[model samples]
Target: MAGSVSPRFARWLAFAGWALVGAGYAFGVLSLMSIGVFVLAGSVVLTLLVRRAWGRGGIAGLVSGLGLPVLYVAYLNRGGPGWVCTTSGPAMSCTDAWNPWPWLAVGVAFVAGGIALQLRRPAAAG
Candidate 1:
């Protein structure tokens, strides 16, 4: 089926989505993150609506689209050991932290889903 969403446009959308996501994390801005997610989701939906939704281009677009949320959560739960200490003229303070297993698990799930999408059979073109 003919579509307004060209492969080049879809690719650009994916690139923009990832860029916004990365910038959001770098700047710690929720608004950027939210917009990035919506853009990425839109790219995937548009890809699916056009001809050959399961084709190589579409599959690549979908996998990259999924990366948007994956990047979001990755930043949210940047799992790593954490600790803080402060001292000022005999005054001291310390805080302990632990790794975010749950969030990391969610990231893994997103990755797996993307991989599965990549392996999907392409639909026969009309």
Candidate 2:
């Protein structure tokens, strides 16, 4: 079975996928839910579509797929130049918007890693 993904990696991937799904729903971030679904579904689709030859490249493909939506959502929520305001009985305060740069950086890194993984050849089997 050349290029078959290991069972261990598959199990870990499944666990990560479910965790993402749970976290997304728990945190009320629907975009995360979407990404989780994509990961899970992509795994299955790749498994069937690529069969034995999917290998690490398939994992990389999923990582790439996972990144796109994250980038999109992060971009949308990147926040504008303004103060987030709050008030209480003759008192008022304001703060800057939640920064999306961290998320964007992470997304970019993951995307780059995925692409790099795909470009690199798999290690030789023992």
Candidate number of the best TM-score: 2
Cα lDDT of model 1 by residue, 3-78, tens digit: 6777556544444444333333332333454575665455445544442432334343344444455556555545
**What local distance difference test score does each model get?**
0.47, 0.51
Off by over 4 Å in 2: 1-58, 80-97, 122-126
lDDT of 2 by residue, 16-123 (tens): 443333333322344445565565555455445443443333345445555655666567556634556779999997767556777688678766776566446343
Q: Candidate 2 lDDT (Cα, whole model)?
A: 0.51
Q: Indicate which candidate wins on lDDT.
A: 2
TM-score of each: 0.35, 0.44
